[model samples]
Target: MKRSEQNVVARSSLPWNHSCGSKSFAATMSTKAEIPHFVDFFKESHWSKKKDDWLDHKCMEKHGELENLRTMCSQPDAIPMSQEEMSVAVLGKKSGYLRGYGVGRKPCNTNTTSRDNGEEVIILREELSSLKELNDTQQQQLEAQNEQLAIQQQQIKAQNQKLEKFQEVLLRCGLLSSDECGEESTEGG
Candidate 1:
């Protein structure tokens, strides 16, 4: 691994230090126009975002990603914002690894259409589970119904054979005449 990557690993593995103060979040863009490695970012962070939405100047400054640069540059806005307020706004706008944006922000999280994508995933999983359960039940019922129909068919076949034998015996004993054995019955004048 590169020295910078090793440093990152070291920092991550090191125990938490209360005195170490705040964390430094990496900005999507760096000064001097360094080519953004979006694919690399996503691969490393395991989060995806569009190329256009990767960078936002306000968010960079708010999240302290541009803090070092900010110290050297003049304040862009005259309105002084409280640290707490800035932190809250930044948190609300920032997502894990990927950037967060407020209302009217362009390129909103691709994962969500009108609601939380995470919630949508959960709901879909539940619906799928219910559908699977229903399918299993229907399949079981179908098998049972088929078995019952087969048994009924067998019983009917046996009853038909028994009735044929009984008719044949009656005919042989002259109890039922040939005309009564399903032949056309015509009355003599």
Candidate 2:
């Protein structure tokens, strides 16, 4: 009947079905709400107190068997790209939001795409070169070790020859018995 009453009927999405018994009841059940914006984004959101609530059904059941992941999705980098072109470069083939699209599989909108550039390849090249250099150094060290081993073997061979000659001389001079040299002692006593 009034402007406020008319406004209430016009604004309300649903029709007023229930008949108010009292004037106070009708006053309390008006179309107007304290919240100026009727559309509440987080009005129906529920907060999870437990960590296992976020996981998949199977994972939730077998929490102990599998790794308890903090998040299944990959986290984005911290780099900021303010410009549209930078956003385009960062986003790459996944610019549906900026370009305008109704429905599409959204690319992982993480800043980790910066690594896909040539700069990362250059970094990888440097790492590979350094590893190769280290390998060469290790190879050289191994060769040096082999040379030292060969020298020691030659010295041992020379000493062994000298000892053999000394043993022969001792046997000839009757200083060491043949039995004492290698064979068992001949004298039973």
Candidate 3:
């Protein structure tokens, strides 16, 4: 293994001080442009008190892969983002803290592998087409619900008409008075 890799491995094995005075590895390294290895951060003081769980073991096994991804993302050819975008990505937009305030203003690097412009456009078009199809399906479902609502309204109107007819018939047969049928007698004395 390379000297730096060996150093990182050695650091990962070291016991971390979890006292109040101790700053987290993430807090210390946040300002630096280089992304630290996952093992370096997670293996340190944070969860040292707990048993080495399955998740920790799994993450440790894949730390190298995570480091590789970080390296790829931080490459010079990666896409540039606005300060606001970087802040949102790092702190999350919903967080109450102002942009680039809580953490040191280290911007996240975006991974942008080379792709043909035409191919990229085609991929975006395909995604847009899929979204349109989803919107159309939702619209169709809404229209169906509206149609059902209209049909229900018509059915209720018909039922009300039948009930009115029944009430009129009962009134004529003397089984129901105008008061009993919830109607005022219109005839004047």
lDDT of each prediction vs. the true structure? 0.49, 0.44, 0.55
Residue pairs with backbone atoms closer than 3 Å in model 3 (clashes): none
- The residue-by-residue lDDT of candidate 1 on 11-31, one tens digit each, is 677422111124222333232
- Rank by lDDT, descending? 3, 1, 2
Q: Candidate 3 — which residues are off by over 4 angstroms?
A: 1-120, 183-189
Candidate 2 lDDT by residue in tens digits, 1-189: 999999787747421211222332224324336522111101111112344242234323232221112122123644533323332332234434431111232254334355455567898999999999999999999999999999999998887778777778899999988878664222311
Question: Against the hidden reference, what TM-scores do the models get?
Answer: 0.39, 0.42, 0.38
User: Candidate 2 has which clashing residue pairs, if any?
Assistant: none
List ranges where model 2 is wrong by over 4 Å.
1-115, 183-189
| TM-score (C-alpha) between model 1 and the true structure | 0.39
What is the per-residue lDDT of model 3 for residues 83-163, given as tens digits with 9 covering 90 to 100? 334435543464434322333333332223234455678999999999999999999999999999999999988877788
- The model with the greater TM-score, 1 or 2, is 2
| Per-model C-alpha RMSD | 18.1, 16.2, 15.4
